[model samples]
Target: MRVYTLFTPSHKGLYEDYFLKTLPDEFELHATELFEQECPTGSFYHEGWDKICYRKVELFVAACEESMGEHFFYCDVDVQFFGNVVDLLVREIGDFDIACQDDVTAYCSGVFVCKASHTTLAMFKAMKRNYNREDQTTLNEHLHMCQHKKLSPAFFTYGRVAARPWSGERFRVPENVLLHHANFVIGVENKKQIMDYTREKNFS
Candidate 1:
């Protein structure tokens, strides 16, 4: 399996460094840097959340087309992997066209496993055409219309789980979790501090 991720200017001093350092060597990793010049024409290139989502779809579809692997996994740069995620995903994907963690309203697009097929390509195209609220929302809509596997939160923990202490919520990080995503819960500096702590605690 091949893993693909995107990085924009705002992520430069934040996620980019940690992600590049921590990404395992076992899988083929494709990291796309989204510069203003690279943004596709006819698309809003404003420096905002929507622009980031648009670039993610563009980069993801490009990676899917360029990869030779039968299966492709897309992960946000804010995610950290502790195990052989590709192996785990390949085993868990089964016969589904796509697999991801369900985030109540929709499956989180931060981490997902997709089979490289015409159907997958078409779904991505449809997602690009229907740029609504965000990439995850659009992806969820398409996923609802296709064959997909909804992974348990244990496999791909998000910010709510990672930052439970801040919200006065208690949760456990499952022993089998392969990936942890630090979503829009905290600022970049705080994220860096947490990443430093995580690296020393687990990855060292």
Candidate 2:
């Protein structure tokens, strides 16, 4: 099992450095930085309302294909691992395509596990071809299209998790601790504090 992440200039780096430091040395870690140079507007997308989503998904598919692992995981930089996540993932959902919950269902496509098999590749291609160019909308649509087929749910986790009095212990432990960290900027300072406290006690 390996870990993968995508980032742009806009994304901050403390969280990425933190995660790289935290993962066990045994697990392979990979990352692809998406910059304007590589994704010059015309390369990934034509300027339009859908440009952002199209560019992101297109880049993701390209990276997954080029990566040299039998299994590829798409993880958000903000998502941190507090425990031995590789062990947990192997134990629960080995060699499967796992996706995050899309839309108001909670979370974004911040994490996913792909098998890299022929069928899985086909599904990914389908995603590129049928992409609605609206992340949530396209992802949900892809999830449905891949149902019980190659693409299946490996796990769904809460997005932007941070230890807080308001969160109680519930947010700290999930039914599945596949990924945990802050996604959006709202409540970030507080989230950072909570994350720091948890890392001191739990992650390191």
Candidate 3:
């Protein structure tokens, strides 16, 4: 299967390079500019990157709709898969239009899945409406819809973190799921050091 990731000019090559090193050779990586350059730079989640954030997400959802593939997995660059995700997805989930990790507390949005279909396209349009540059909110609405049967969860197996209701595991993914979100917020010098360390070790 093909794997896709959205990254901006700020992402540099380290993140993509590490991703290439981590996944199996069969999983091809496709890179694209996450958003249109013309989108206005406004107050985007206090990061001033909000305009691009919304556009990029919509772009991904739209692209997935026309793709003639078996599955489309959407991932954030700041997060990384720590286990054999393809094996996990291949072994545990199948034939789903869309799947995503449930934010039981209304928070997480690091990963999600979708199958190529027009229904998914409509859903993406709805999700994009009234978007506040806060991706989690849009995803939360979709997750809630899935919970209510307007959407189907069977088509989606939320990540292991949301499986806690059935498995009794902790909510924090670094401990419970096959992935981890390193919300690294160190100073510039420390950030550089960490990046350098990651480059040296290839932890990705």
> Which candidate has the highest lDDT of all?
1
- Candidate 2 per-residue lDDT, tens place, 26-127, comes to 567766666643323322233442654565577567656765356556666555665565555444345345444332344356565555555656665777
Every model's TM-score: 0.80, 0.64, 0.62
Error of 1 at 68 (Å): 6.5
lDDT of 1 by residue, 156-186 (tens): 4435454342232334444555566655344
For candidate 1, the clash count comes to 0
Which residue ranges in model 3 land beyond 4 Å of their true spot? 34-44, 102-104, 144-178, 183-204
C-alpha lDDT of all candidate models, in order:
0.67, 0.51, 0.49
User: Runs in model 1 with CA error above 4 Å?
Assistant: 37-47, 159-172, 196-204
lDDT of 1 at 18: 72
